[model samples]
Target: MNDHAPRRANRIALMIGHCAGMIDLVALPVWVGTLITRYGLAPQQAGLLATLFLGGAVCASLFWAPRFQRIAPERVAGWGFGIAGIAFAAMTQTSDYGAMAALHALAGLAAGSALSVTHGTIGSGEQPHRSFAMAGLALAVFGIFILGGTPVLVERAGGPALFKVFAAVMIVAALTSVAAFPRRQGATEQGQRSTAHIDSTVWYAAVGISCMGLVQAMMFSFVERIGADRGFGVAAVTGVLVALGIVNLAPAPLAALLERRWPARYVVLAGPVVQATLALIISHSSEFAPYAGATAAYAAVMIFTHTFAFGLIARLDPGGRALSATPAMLMIGAAIGPVLGGTLVQHAGYTSLGNATLAIATVAVCCFARAGRTRAVLSEA
Candidate 1:
């Protein structure tokens, strides 16, 4: 058995898979904006549309991840990426909200499958951390592309044209996955079957991840609206998102450094606290410079939290299925978050919405802290 072959194939799959994931996310805000502008969707309806995508992802992951464990993971991933690409292409032709929603849901389902299979492939390898780091790097680069380039693309190409471009990208990613991913013999041959029950530690990690997702969804969904309400223009909002993407790119290496120096638990706990403080500061200040600084801070904290929580779950679960399940749980919370945040914004405005997010962050920090302590004590015992 050539060990290097599987590992190399896994790395390639992770990079392509994460690129696909980012394309899905990058399309999200733009899709919501399209629904609002072209279809005259209310903010709540736009939020719900985002929620529907996430909800579909959650359901698909929960039902489909285990089945992939029984089938050929890499082939499943290839098919998923292809389906997602086709779904993106279909978006260019649809003006009907129901049709768009259904297609987006299908896209979400495919995204979930790709994510699960990619993680499963990476997790099967010996040096999972290195694989995860590579995956994180891909995510950061994709974020940079989406944040920095999407606005320009939208301006130059228009919405339909932008979808066409992304469709092309997705098709390329799908084709690459098919070429690069190795054939898995079977799920059982790859590893042990994952028991379906959620461990308490994994549950705590899931909560932390979900809270992180909630904060992120709120930021992505309303950051522009908040900036506009606070007297900044569209360019400023795009600038902040781009800055956030840059900050997200910086943290993968920083997370590697911190992981070398400190325990994963400490990094996980600190991230939410930092994010909460930044959110609180942003809630109080309406100034553009201060808000931008706060937004950068929020971005850094979110990157750290997301990476740490994901790493922790990967480490805690001996069975790699936890990788798939953790993200699924987080996506469920993400599905719920934007709708709730939009309601708060509708009734109480952006500041109050920020406050609500801060409260959630605080609770998340406490939960992570408790879980960390419990893990420490068990290790000592």
Candidate 2:
């Protein structure tokens, strides 16, 4: 019991940190809605503000990732979340758009810094695939919580209530992490040493994952709009979003189960193709049945595929620096997706978005294939 307790506590802290780091996905709707309704910002303005958060996160990830070996992952995580909590607390005091914008960026930077190290530490664990999947599962559960509860809380208490809730979450994660965050494993038994530099395969893998992120953000940002534009009605659209959230719970465990059965390389290769197909369906389908089904399954691809990718990258680079840069790779495309998708919709229409996804998906497949070829060499090393 004594030995088990600390391990259990470490997992919970790491899991919670993962969820908090990725809070932007579930919290984005509330953030944008609050900005538009409470602060009277235009949609474009709200989007740019959100982009500032993502931009800050990307910058932090890129800056911190290279130093993964030098810094204590737990210390970085604790300080990052602590700073983020302060930023969130500050947000509750302001209704000024400029002030809120700066706070969002600060929160994002701190959160991203914590997230990068958290992912790095996980990647250095005994079972990287299962560890990342567990983190993914926690994020899914957290998603349901935020979706079900946060909006109602905000409705009753106003937009500032949302920031208060965010602050509280960050503080809890910070305290827990500092108290119990686990140390990463030393270099692998197979002689995978901690190298300052990773090879091209890791870069290829990162590019492939980034392409998928681009597709997810580009299509997902407009899913409700697509449904509404096609006369799916409010009830139907809401049902899809609700179903989507619930369905998200399955992918992480499923990926863990399939870790041995499915080759990670094949999964990475297949993910973007599957993602592009679903995006096409979501973008072009006039009928509700097809659109709802595709929209619900859309995010699952990234979650499931990323679990495998994380494991594979950890094996290829035991130093953990590449995995630490996970946030930057994921968010680089995401940061640009909304603005670029909107431009495409404004100029070329929804089909153009589908076409774009196809092109991007092809690029992802090619990159993954190149990475796969080298995996035969590095994964064994």
Candidate 3:
């Protein structure tokens, strides 16, 4: 009935979809731990399973993104989440490594397809930075539930319960998408075909975001194990994760507030430095206090910086095609993170992750620097 109502509903739907789609960010620590403790998998084996999931997501996103304007995003989003729901439901039924691996890939494909559409729509908003930050704020709240609850659920019901939760969340997203997913303007969609194809800047931003994702996912996937190996018990470790979720709440809002003050370029540049520093501390610290502090703050770097990058890219590419590749941009490096990190931890040590983070962070900074300042990027606020 009101003009603002549809936009509000769209934002809410995007938030729900994001929470369901980005499960790796919220559940990786417990997910990896479950694979190791419950299924008797080696660290690399467990990390490979995670990698398979992200790789599938990357594949799906890259395929669907360029075709975004050609298709009905709502239908695609609904069907994607539905398929993911089914896959995760099946995942709850098996302990077989092969079966689980297949299911994880299927779920990632569906989830990535859905999420790319979700992010594209958000990028099409009047203020993409604020929209992304809003979605991220919701994700942070969801992270609180996930970070606090998943370990206990696994403790009581084993790893299958984790898939059950994923299934439920996906099912809910599927349902909401049918009625709430917003469609882009037809004239804009028609015009996007001609001009939006120049993607050099988009690719650079994507690479920069992906590098940060690599560091985030690598350290995140192992935080639980790292803490346990250092002799911190489950309660203490989980407390840090919960604290991490709580800390996540601030960055999005902070990014939103800073939009008027800080230049997106400077924010993007600062992100990798903060990310690598926190990651080094998180991986190398034997002390619980330092590890807890660093781990709690680490993810905030990506969240805050990515809020700026998402906004910048949306400004750079108004057609939404480039923004539609959100999953691929974020997940390409993430796909390698777990397996690479596990290999490093296996042969080298946890401390090696710090070195890896530094390397990745340097790459991210370089990419972000090249992303440059468009007139739109400079005019943010």
Ranking by TM-score: 3, 2, 1
**295-355: candidate 1 lDDT, tens digit per residue:** 7556557656666666666566645677766447667777876677667777877777668
| Every model's TM-score | 0.89, 0.89, 0.96
Candidate 2 lDDT trough over 10 residues, lowest sum: 184-193
Question: What's the lDDT for all of these models?
Answer: 0.68, 0.81, 0.86
Model 3 Cα lDDT, one tens digit per residue, 8-74: 6776888898888888887889888889988899889999999988998899899988787678888
lDDT of 2 by residue, 142-231 (tens): 877775676568768988888898899899889988998986444444224665457779999999988887787777766766776689
The alpha-carbon lDDT assigned to residue 8 of candidate 3 equals 64
Clashes of each: 0, 0, 0
Report model 2's TM-score to 2 decimal places.
0.89
Q: Weakest 10 consecutive residues, lDDT, candidate 3? A: 189-198
Best by TM-score: 3
